[model samples]
Target: MEISGSAFNSGLNAIQAGQRRVDQAATEIASNTLPQAPVETPPAQQVNPSPSGAANTQADLAESLVALNVGKTEVQAGAKVVETADEVLGTLIDTRA
Candidate 1:
């Protein structure tokens, strides 16, 4: 049994459409929104700006502040881990020699 060209194309189209719908639904459910790939970020959503650029600026500032705090936390955690490892290595060397 062989399918014609048009039938094959229609089947492929249905498969593609199903895949897109699944992708969209997955995005909506995860991460408050899922951007399929982190390397290609979605553009920021635009809010009304006739009179409230201040609010937008403030929001951007707030997002930066939170991000900065998270970065600081990770740095602190990494430092602690490195420090512990250094101390262990020093002790091992002292005991070996």
Candidate 2:
């Protein structure tokens, strides 16, 4: 089946967006400076608690890595779609000529 140019453009756009997300995630992971989500504790449960920076950081890192992996997969899929579209278009043009 043939794909339109707009479809190909959309695929390329997806690739660009996915790459940006992957890069941002990598940078955050490498720098270890991701912003932490505020931890909320009920007043009743607020019994003196020790600092949890280490735990928070570990959880954040894990989440960031997962996001990075997902972004990488998106980029790969987008690139494949664009590639296939290009090939199909090329074949169509050749056939027309």
Candidate 3:
């Protein structure tokens, strides 16, 4: 099945949104003082890309897809981080206010 542009766009937007959430989470976490503070790894750090093609377009496409999937996983992990941060922030703010 061919993917429509709109569908692709939707997916991209969702990914972007998730990334934003993750960033917000990390920021919130950074602002607080806690025991055993978690080490947050950025998405780019998790993915390593090597050129997969030797003057071959097919191999290039495969490499690109691998990179894309890796990116998606990073974004997902980020989203989880964001959610965790959001929850912590909410609790703190509620207690302080």
lDDT per residue for candidate 3 within 30-58, as digits (tens), equals: 43324454567687895654444234545
* Candidate 1 lDDT over residue span 15-96, tens digit each: 4554554454444335333344534334564443254754665565566555545545544554555555566667767888
Models, CA RMSD each: 22.5, 5.3, 20.1
lDDT per model vs. reference: 0.50, 0.85, 0.55
In every candidate, how many clashes are there? 0, 0, 0
In candidate 3, list every pair of residues with a backbone clash: none
lDDT winner, 1 or 2: 2
Per TM-score, the best of the predicted structures is 2
User: For residue 59, what is the lDDT in candidate 3?
Assistant: 52
Over 51-80, each residue of candidate 2 has an lDDT whose tens digit, in order, gives: 696788889889889989989998998998
Q: Let me know the TM-score candidate 3 reaches against the reference structure.
A: 0.40
Candidate 3 or 2, higher lDDT:
2
Superior by TM-score: candidate 1 or candidate 3: 1
Q: How many backbone clashes does candidate 2 have?
A: 0
TM-score of each: 0.44, 0.74, 0.40
Q: Summing lDDT over every window of 10 consecutive residues in candidate 3, give the lowest-scoring window.
A: 1-10
Give the RMSD in angstroms, all C-alphas superposed, for model 2: 5.3
